[model samples]
Target: MGTSPDRSFFPGSHWLYFSVYLLAFLVGLPLNLLALVIFVGKLRRRPIAVDVLLLNLTVSDLLLLLFLPFRMVEAASGMRWPLPFILCPISGFLFFTTIYLTSLFLTTVSIERFLSVAYPLWYKTRPRLGQAGLVSVVCWLLASAHCSVVYVMEFSGNSSYSQRTIETCYQEFREDQLAVLLPVRLEMAVVLFVVPLLITSYCYSRLVWILGRGASHRHRKRVAGLVGATLLNFLVCFGPFHMSHVMGYILGESPVWRSLVLLLSTLNSCVDPLVYYFSSSGFQADFHELLRRLRGVTAPSQQEGSMELKVQKEGEGQGQDCTVQTV
Candidate 1:
């Protein structure tokens, strides 16, 4: 059998990975946090079933963002397990699990949106909120279980750390381990990623065809934005990771692209909020309200300033009237 991929450092690959992950964390965290607050506020106002799933999606993205510092530390230390071995797998587990959960929710949101527009009657009969919540719970469990494999896959047959400070976590595995990991990783990329990509593409395509005929220009624009953002998230974030995994499996060499692709995968947190904002009317309204609140704060200051100016002008006129009377 062919040997496993070369696990050696690719010159500046570590530095590049560290820098990109830091950038992704900086960019993704605040956006996902904003989305999370918006989604939570939305849930309080009214119980739109779709918002539940969108809320879950936002939370998933946030979860992924939470673990980025660990990865950055690993990269900064030249792929060494700088932290405890237990923590290494925990970070790896959360990273993949949450990202995959995001994919699942994105797919679900697309189908939900398409159904509401495409088939209103059938959609009404469906339990939107209940079903969304159930599916989300199920996905969370399955994703957690799937990611549990990270620890097993990483810790087996190799010392968790090297004689030097550097060691692999999820990045590299032994040649003997390749046989088992190859099939599993390939299947996951196909099932978790490729399947969702195809489903969202089809759902959005049909939505365009159906909505195109009757939807107003504004409505169509909204649909297109929603569809485009969803596809772009997968294309830009998950697509590279999916491709790299399969190619690495076949080539038996972990390429430099592996680190880059993984970093890209974390970007879903940064982009998924855009999807939430554009796709849902409630989210947009919430965003608008948040903007209004910010503007409202300044509004009072302006109002107070005007009132102060009017009072000063009236006092000045009274003082002049008194001077004129005295003269």
Candidate 2:
């Protein structure tokens, strides 16, 4: 392995990660919270597999956003650990676990959607929601367990009081052995990337096939939109991040790549809300309705007030001097 001089791990785009975290904090939390409310609100009436997966996805996104504050602190302090050094590994573990869980559940959502649209009758008859919930819980639990390996390895922190008092977080190699990194890195690539990618591709392809073979036009169109949106998000939001990791794994990791990796990793939270918007028609309609209500509520009450004022003026102008008031 090759090594490079130690410098600011994230130099130019420190601002970018911080900004993305701010955005993730703003958009992701609220959207996922709303989704959770809506899904749980109607669970008694409609037990849907897709909704279950969506709930999982939303919760995962929420958890991922929860880590942003610590991230922002780290970035704002110029990549130094001002807090307890023990917290570093825990934070790192949570970060990777959340990422893995998100990918796993997104793939599950796509597969569930595919099955619901492509095999409606079978999907209805089968124990879909129950099965899906079990699977989702397993995925999250498994991801947590897998990522806990870092904690098990007991990685050392790079703390220094020189110049800037920097304390960098990194996994310590056992016995200075490359094999130690190999297993965890491979596990991450496989669980987080390979499996999810295969499932997504397969599900979307099957959806396309079903649509091509004369599925309902409305359903086909909706599914096509979903597939397009999901694929777009998978490519734009996640593809670069994982691809960069693959490159580093295959080529090599230098200090220069660290900034880029962090930048890509931080972006998934921002882009995922867009994916959620596009994938779920119910959510889109509800979100639009919410916007309309908000606009109506905040429209200065100007239109209604003006109408009331006009009516009152006209009433006063009458001979009886009657007044009409809005109740």
Q: Encode model 2's per-residue lDDT on 1-327: one tens digit a residue.
A: 312223544455556667777877887777777667766654656767777777777777777788778888876765555767666667778887877777787788888777777778998788567788799889888889888866654443323422323355542233443345544665677768778888999988987887788777766776777677566556666666666556646653422454555555556665566656666667677667766877888786888899999999887687354433321
Cα lDDT tens digits, model 1, 31-122, are: 77777788787778776778889888878877777888888888788776678677777888899998889888888888888898888898
**Residue 320 in candidate 1 has what lDDT?**
100
Candidate with maximal TM-score: 1
State the TM-score for model 1. 0.84
Winner by lDDT: 1
- Give the TM-scores of the predictions, in the order they appear: 0.84, 0.78
**lDDT of predicted model 2:** 0.67
Model 2 earns a TM-score of 0.78
How close to the true structure is residue 19 of candidate 2, measured as C-alpha lDDT?
76
